[model samples]
Target: MTRRTVRIAMNGVTGRMGYRQHLVRSLLAIREEGGLELEDGTILWPEPVLVGRRAPALRAIAERHGLEHWTTDLDAALADPSVEIYFDAQVTAARAAALRRAVAAGKHLYCEKPTAASLQAALEIARLAQDAGVRTGVVQDKIFLPGLRKLKRLVDGGFFGRILSVRGEFGYWVFEGDWQSAQRPSWNYRAEDGGGITMDMFPHWEYVLHELFGRITTVQALTATHLPQRWDEYGKPYAATADDAVYGVFQLDGGVVAQINSSWAVRVHRDELVEFQVDGEHGSAVAGLRDCRVQHRATTPKPVWNPDLPSTEPFRQQWQEVPGNGEFDNAFKAQWELFLRHVVLDEPWRWDLLAGARGVQLAELGLRSSAEGRRLDVPELTL
Candidate 1:
């Protein structure tokens, strides 16, 4: 079978997510699998043209991946008529300018979110793409996870009757780079560098909540900088200006309440780095990255409030495990395939730059809510 290639000028491929998830896992994995088969049976292959600021990094990545195209020049890459898509995985501060250039070049836009540092920039980029008549997509990777997919299945299957509330816990102890090197980059700890728990995580919560349950109508948030001082990559002590933790409550459209706590300072006691528990009249489900367990009302344990006695029931074992029912691909890779199909085949794609702007709006509102120490309404955005 013949393969139809799509050249993607993938910016920021040297970064952790850009390299590992997008390039190595998604595009390369798709290539390894003989690419995506279209309706006409031609395999659609993604050829990544690695773009970044550093020539050595770009060249090294291209050489490592056995990729032929790479450049340190964004303008030159955009000028290439054959490059049909531009994928941005750069830092939040650098994303807007790169996206604007890409949109102007008439390339299809697929990128990581929050698309820009602020809602205005995000909306502008979305509008630019729309005006250019380019197909666009944003990475809403969490919804593609096996656990969330199962959760969505249950929701669509009506397993949860009259859904009531949701609780989400997401965090891990990120090393402060004092004794051990920080797992994440140092820029993530500085507000001036576009770093904050609210900005980093609220967007994720926005899409996840809106998609799985209902659109979030309002949000109340409390943010904290748990660690005031942290050592950077160079072992130099820097004041951590960004909020390391955020506790937020979201009111969805159907009066379903959702509370999510996101923190970089917390130690994990759960099975996964992130988890969500959804409760409804009929049943309740706890879903992690790869596992989802549910307890129907009939099987739910009745525990009377007793401060005098230790729990006798095995609470964790009571819920039934939700099976995959099928093989699951890497979450990032799965979304990549969908975006590829959208671009190459003009298939219906829902998660676009507009959706990305909504995520950004949520983050911005979350910050404002925290600062004002009050609840805030989320207004709808129009292009």
Candidate 2:
């Protein structure tokens, strides 16, 4: 059996998502498990060279993860023929420029979503990658989640006959840092830093909606900077120039209406940080991060609406829990493995740069819809 090693230039390892999801959970975990095994008994090992601006931070991450390579010089890393893939998880505004460099240098591309800050930039990146003949992908990690997978199974099994609507509740309170420290990075609140809840979350919504229901045909969005002032990491206050919350309604190709609420200002009163409820003619289901509950029309309870009497029905107990059919891995890691195969085995990669541009298009158009205070039709994005 032949063994091959793919060296990836992993830029932005110090950031939260890059560190935890990409590096620790996906890359290092794959290496620890003896690499990705192929069907014909070959093993493909992934060797990531940590690339960052800070030498100490890079060195520390490499050492902690028992990795062999760490480099602060991105130019040097890109110039090296040994590095076959270039990944970016930097600030949104900086992504397209870095990606241009990567594609120009003739490296396979994969990175976080909202590939660029704007649709124009995102489409340009896609075009450049196509002209360069490089394999490219953007993270669409939400669909790989267990709960959503279960929801998809129900859809495939015809459990939901003619789906009607989907309601999603996402987000929890992020402290202002006066007393409790904010869970998110301070840059997340600054518009100049390419920060906004709509920009951050719409990509997730785009992929989830397209994959499960259908393509989004139109959108109506209302965004808000709920708390205009918040404390930074240093406990110093700053005016938030970007939205912390968004309320959106999307029209899907299959006539599915999806309404989602994303907010950092609101408190969580649900089962998880994110949850989606789907209603159809035959049944209904609600899915959280790890669990899903379903109630069919046959078993669904009916309650009379009475203003004068207190309701005593066990509403929650009426739904049955969906069984976990099999082992589920980390959502990010699952996509990482598939991407590795797409790069190495010449497999069909559907979630290409074009798909990424579509996500960027949604965010851009969604913002425009909110500003215009009207429903905007979403034109199909093409390369």
Candidate 3:
């Protein structure tokens, strides 16, 4: 039997996510896991070639990973017959054009989210990939997250019987890019660069809501630029043209109301600060990045609310910590492995370009809802 190895060309290898998430964690780390086994017991390994604009950065990354193939020319990598898959981790503004080129070159695509800056662009890319008959996927990493997966399990197990509503609190104060040294790239604060909390986070919530709950049918949103100006990495001030905080209400199928607050201004105050509180008819569940807790009627005990009472005994016993069994891989890396299997072994990967398009649709609708101060019905896209 021939040992099948999928050769992947990674675009934007120098970027933060490209380096840490995709390159190191996903490709190198997963490769070091003795490769991934397919359902048929066949093993698949990824051979990644780092592609970026900077030679020094690319070389440094390649050397750090003990990889020999590194190049600054995208066309050269794309033209290589050995490169069967093209992965894009470029900026949102640059993703469409690059992916289009890759698709035209007949390489399968696995790209970062928002697939494109706008819904139209996303749709076009999806159409292009479909027309070419090439395998394609998007990064819907949150769906693979351990906490979110556990939440899905509870939802599947009917733990939250007839979920009534979902409340998501996601975000932490991003460094002001000044004396604090920004946690994110400077472009993320600018609208022209397709950087904003809404654009960055809505796709994640969309997948989470749709996968764990149901599809969103309508959205009413209000966005704010709380910090009009922010400092860059060098302490240089730049106008924040995009929203730093976004509040949106999504009405899912079956009348499930999901209210999401995604912000860059809030401080991290609790464990698994990014939480999803789901209330149901018989029970409620709260899931975070690290833990999940539930409160069912069977386990709930009647308690009196008192301001001066010591809060040690009543409800504390009711709350149970979900176990962390060390089976959870980084979200991005898990998605990467799934995509690789999908491309090589024909496994079903839900985060396709169409799913990505739907996310962009929701973001666009949210922005329109904010601008018009009216609820917008989300249109379904043909996959």
Best by lDDT: 1
- Candidate 3 lDDT tens digits, 1-383: 23568899999889998888888888888789877777666777789888888898888888877898989889999999989999999999999999999999999999888899998899998999999999999888877778887888889988877889999998899878767888888899899988988888888888889998999999999999998889987789999999999999999999999999999999987576699889998888888876788888788777777879776555545777666656998988888888887887787777889999998988888888899999999877895
In model 1, where do residues sit more than 4 Å from their true spots? none
TM-score of each: 0.99, 0.99, 0.95
- Pairs of colliding residues, candidate 3: none
Give residue 24's lDDT in candidate 2 (0 to 100).
Answer: 93
lDDT of each: 0.93, 0.92, 0.87
Model 2 ranges off by over 4 Å: none
Worst 10 residues of 1 by lDDT: 56-65
What's the lDDT of the predicted structure labeled candidate 2? Answer: 0.92
- Residue pairs with backbone atoms closer than 3 Å in model 2 (clashes): none
Q: Between 2 and 3, whose lDDT is larger?
A: 2
lDDT: the better of candidates 1 and 2: 1
Clashes of each: 0, 0, 0
Clashes by residue pair, model 1: none
